[model samples]
Target: MVGRTLTAVAKLSTVPAWVRRPLPAVAGVEDFLLRLYRRTESAEALAGFIALSWLGGEAADGPLLWAAPPEERFARAFLAVADALAEGESYPPPEWWRAEAGCLAPMTEAQWNERAGSWPERFYAHGVVCALGWVLGVFDDPAIMAPLHCGDGRSVGYGPREEWRVRLRACAVPLHLRNEEIAEWLRSGAGSQSGPAAVGAARATPSRSTG
Candidate 1:
């Protein structure tokens, strides 16, 4: 299992270049944000983190645009869904949050409302499940998961509270490495190692493609 983790560590750098807008992190302001990222290591939160990193990555990358494939850019669309949910609104902005354009087909207002009893959980579930599709597409890239380990608030991936976190104690790859590990690894000097440099370096690379 240690072998799997080290391998995943190296591949974090090579995902199709993802692009995202900065995510809002006002404490308590984005409660569902925590649930979505933490509920399960379900790749939905993983999706959020990747998208948010792109936001930071773009900030660092600056006006110089690197063309990423449409698949990698799914983070942008997912962010819009998150932004809408955070704001407690149902209608994600048409421009950035087209559900059909993302991992799942668009949920009709009725279907969306049917599941959501005015509570955000249903919508959150829908969005996360959809986002998972995107994350799954890049599931092979450690870059998608590596940012979760970053301590830099500017780039820290959002999903820290996932189920895999618990598995860390079991010495499982936990795929969901968190900030604390980043610190511990740093102290141990093991943190200096990055994701493995190979395609599909994930603990369990999903064979399914987004298309």
Candidate 2:
């Protein structure tokens, strides 16, 4: 059965085959991620895994994945994976999510399109993380939300896994804080900055293993 499985995996298309291919040196890493995925109930986790597979096992920003402490690294990777799955779309102003007193007004659709078109991924990442912020109870705006594609096996759609939602609930730093950092990145107009630099921040707390 193991041999048959390996053979089947080997015959997949280039991208999927690369994603499913064994990493002998990182076998434990692979196993742990797969096990976590199997046990996870979070649609975000499934979305992250789908993004990971599509990325061919690398973060969207590549080496930046290792630049942060473990907790930040994990959360950023989550953000990265989530960012990858973001379907391109206009995003509302951060104020919409914060719903704070005297916050800036949400952008009009035309305004959002103009700004978002200049840096689509930044806007996309922002929307994705904001939606995640909603999930983490960090934000309150549901009026404008991003849609994601969570590919399950061979089918592509968005929905929670039937069994559990344990993953992404325990990000290293408080998820709200991390979500704010990404929001700040957009608010600051740091589009000229590189992906890692724009998204990176000093560790909010000491690093710890999520594994």
Q: List TM-score per model, in order.
A: 0.28, 0.21
Q: How good is model 1 by TM-score?
A: 0.28
Q: CA lDDT of each candidate?
A: 0.34, 0.34
Candidate 2, superposed: residue stretches over 4 Å from native? 1-162, 166-211
**lDDT, model 2:** 0.34
Candidate 2 RMSD to the real structure: 20.7
**Candidate 2's residue-wise lDDT over 1-211, tens digit each?**
0001111111112222222222321222222324443453223333323332323332233211122221323443444333433444546445532442122233357654553453333333444454334333344432223223221322223343211122222222245666798889778977436465545643444578898
The lowest-lDDT stretch of 10 consecutive residues in candidate 2 is 1-10
Summarize candidate 1's per-residue lDDT along 1-211 as a digit string, tens digits. Answer: 0011110111122233332211222111122323434444323333333333333333232111122333544444444444344345565344433443454345466654443443334333333433333334433222222223221123334454333333222222232445567668679865444445333355456778789
Off by over 4 Å in 1: 1-14, 19-72, 92-106, 115-211
